[model samples]
Every structure is written in structure tokens, then in C-alpha cells.
Target: MDKKVAIVFWSKTGNTKLMANALKESIELQNYQADMFKAYNFDINKAMEYPIIALGCPAMGAETLEESEFLPMYNSIKSVLKDKKVFLFGSYSWGDGKWMRDWAYDAKNNGIILFREPIIAKDKPTDDILLKIKKVGIDLLSD
Candidate 1:
């Protein structure tokens, strides 16, 4: 069997958390092993044990990243992200999703391979948005 995959994120009002859950289901739908984690409980070192990492977060103030748990968790794992296969998704209310774009840029610089363009949604995601998150999970397993 291949290495397991983990979808980790921070969600305020459950927006991004639901996205993470959907991703877990999607990967499982592909007959692959997957897991979900909140930002605070996430362990970068332990996560390093897995080959795939799916990260999600909301667009916070001024379209910057949600600083509370998102920044710290990501910063802890950022350096080792190089060469890891990653998929990114998030919910946004405004600002053209600069947060997701900035995250993708950072991952790229860290040498992680992106499976696709970032999955983004404005405000709370509908079924259509959840479907995209599902596809992201399948894409990761396919890789």
C-alpha cells in the first residue's frame, strides 16, 4: 500500500472544516486511506510521515491568512514541504483569494508539487464547491 494522506486545516464557523471532511471522504471514495485534522492538533513532524498533505484555510482579514492557528501550523511544516505532493483548497468571502494564491506560491517555493490549481470558493461553499474538494482528494490519490 502507498503512504497515507492527511487533510489538515483551521475553520471558523466550520466552513473550511467541512471542506477538509469532504476531502477525506473523497479520498476514501477512491479506495485510499485518508485522515482529517484541525490546525491546533496538527503535528508537522508526524504529518511528515505521510506522503500527501491537503491544506485548507479561510481568507481572513484583508485577505491575509488566518493568523491564529493557520500561520503557525503552516510555518512549522513549511520548510519540509519540499518534494511533498500537496493539494490546496479554501473558502473565501472576498479579495480574489489572495490567501490561497499566496499559499500555493509558498508551497511551490518549498518544492511541493501541486496537483491542480487551488480550489477556491467565495463565502460558504455549496454542493458545487464540495464536489471540487472531492475531486481534489481523488487527484491526490491518483498521483
Candidate 2:
């Protein structure tokens, strides 16, 4: 079976993008095909081609998904995500990561199967956090 995973993300200060890159590297290290995309370049129609999807967006404006691009793209693809195995990760500068919690709740309510709880890091991810992020990628290939 093809075990391809898509890592889609939006980053303003390069923190979230760094996390996305780490995920892509980790997934690829496990010998799984992983594709990385910025939210603007990612076509939602292509989402279902992969068995697993990883989304990253930092907390923005009262701990919400980035409004301009990521939110719209996510909203557009959310309905199609039903029954899809997905994971969420991101970076935050403030406000206790309420955004990730809300996102996970919304995904669950929409019937998206979450591989695990959303992974969050404050500002730029530290080396330790990167390790956790990589583990999340490795876990995607677990049976």
C-alpha cells in the first residue's frame, strides 16, 4: 500500500515552516513519501491522494488559525477530510495554544481521525520540540 503523507503549512515568521520541514524530513527518513506545501500552493483536491495529512499553522489573532490563507484553505478542504487520518502542529507566540485545541475539536467534530493530539511550540521550536515533531512524523507510518 502507498503510505504517502502530505505536510501542508502556513508560516509568517518562518517558525511553522521550520516545523513543516522537520516533519517532511522525518517522514522521508522513515522511507515514506512526504510532500510539503505552503497553504497557498496546496490544492485541496489533491489532499485525498495521500493516506495521511499533516497541517501546520501558528496561532493568530486571539489564538485562531491564520485568517488570510490557512483558514480559508482549511475550511475549503475540511469537509473532504471526513474519515481522513490527519494531524495538526504549529508554533505560537502567545495565549496558551487555544488554537490547536480548538482545531483538534473541530477536526474531531467533523469526523476527521486525529493520529494524536496537536503538537504546539512557543515561537520557534527548540531542539527538544523538534524531536517530538519528528516522532509525530514517524508515528504516521505506524500500523
Candidate 3:
């Protein structure tokens, strides 16, 4: 059976969206079914349809998740995330990606299975970072 993956994210300045698109492209290249969604358009219930999920959101005020939409959506789905395979990625302007770390911790606390440590880029991603992001998508498709 073909595997399915979901790439969902919120991007204010378009940085995180760029990463999401890169991941979606890489996943498709691997022959998996991959869907990309902006946070507002994504329905939390749709996450259960995918074997793997990649979530992205830039660090917001004080190194926290974006409060307006992403955070609420995440909170709604987190409980059901137990034992689910998940990947986290996002861009950060400062503070050493503390937000991603915190988010990862919450995911773990809710029993989600993290494929790897969260991938982070500062502001816009560099070519090297984009390569790494693509690698992450490939890795998630691997057994």
C-alpha cells in the first residue's frame, strides 16, 4: 500500500510555508501520497488518515508556538497523537529554537512518536538547510 503523509503549517512571512513545500516535494519524490495544508485550512480530524505528519510553525513571541491558530489546532489534536509518528520543523529568528524543544517535549508528553529531533532554520532557510529539510521528508518515508 502507498504510504500517506501530511504536511501542515502556519507561515506569517512565508518561511515555514517554504519548508512545508520542500518537504511535500521530497515526500512525493519518494512515491508516497503527500498533502500540504496551511494551518487555517487543515482539519484536525484529517490527521488520522495519514501514517505520518509533519508540522511546522515559526517561533512566535517569547519563543512560543503561534497562538492565533496553530497552537489551538495542535492542542486539539495532541491527545489523539499518542503513538503516532510525527516530524516537527520550523523557522526561528532567535533563542536557539527553544520553542521547538518545548513543542517536542509536549508531543512526547502526549505520547507521540517523534521520528527525530525537530528541524529548525533561522529566518529564511539556507540552501544547506533546505537540503536537510528534504532529507527529513525522505527519512520519514523510510521504514
lDDT of 1 by residue, 1-143 (tens): 58589788888868888888888988887778887888888877867787888888889998877898888988888776776777788888778888888888888887777878888878778999999888778777763
The predicted structure with the larger lDDT, 1 or 2, is 2
For model 2, what is the error of residue 137's alpha carbon versus the real structure, in angstroms, after optimal superposition?
1.1
lDDT head-to-head 2 vs 3, winner:
2
Best-matching candidate per TM-score:
2
Candidate 3 local Cα displacement, residue 74, angstroms? 0.5
Candidate 1 regions exceeding 4 Å error are none
Error of 2 at 89 (Å): 0.4
Ranking of models by lDDT? 2, 3, 1
Q: Give the clashing pairs for model 3.
A: none
| TM-scores, all models, native as reference | 0.91, 0.95, 0.95
lDDT for each residue of candidate 3 in 1-143, tens digit (9 for 90 to 100): 46888898999888998899899989889888889887777665887777788999999999999998999888877866675679999998888899999999998888888999888999999888889999998988878
Q: In every candidate, how many clashes are there?
A: 0, 0, 0
- Model 1 poorest ten-residue lDDT run: 134-143
Which regions of candidate 2 deviate over 4 angstroms?
Answer: none
For model 2, residues 1-143, the per-residue Cα lDDT tens digits are 88999899999999999999999999999888999888987766888687789999999989999998899889888877775679899999989989999999998888888889888999999999899999988888898
The residue pairs in collision within model 2 are: none
Q: How many residue pairs of model 3 clash at the backbone?
A: 0
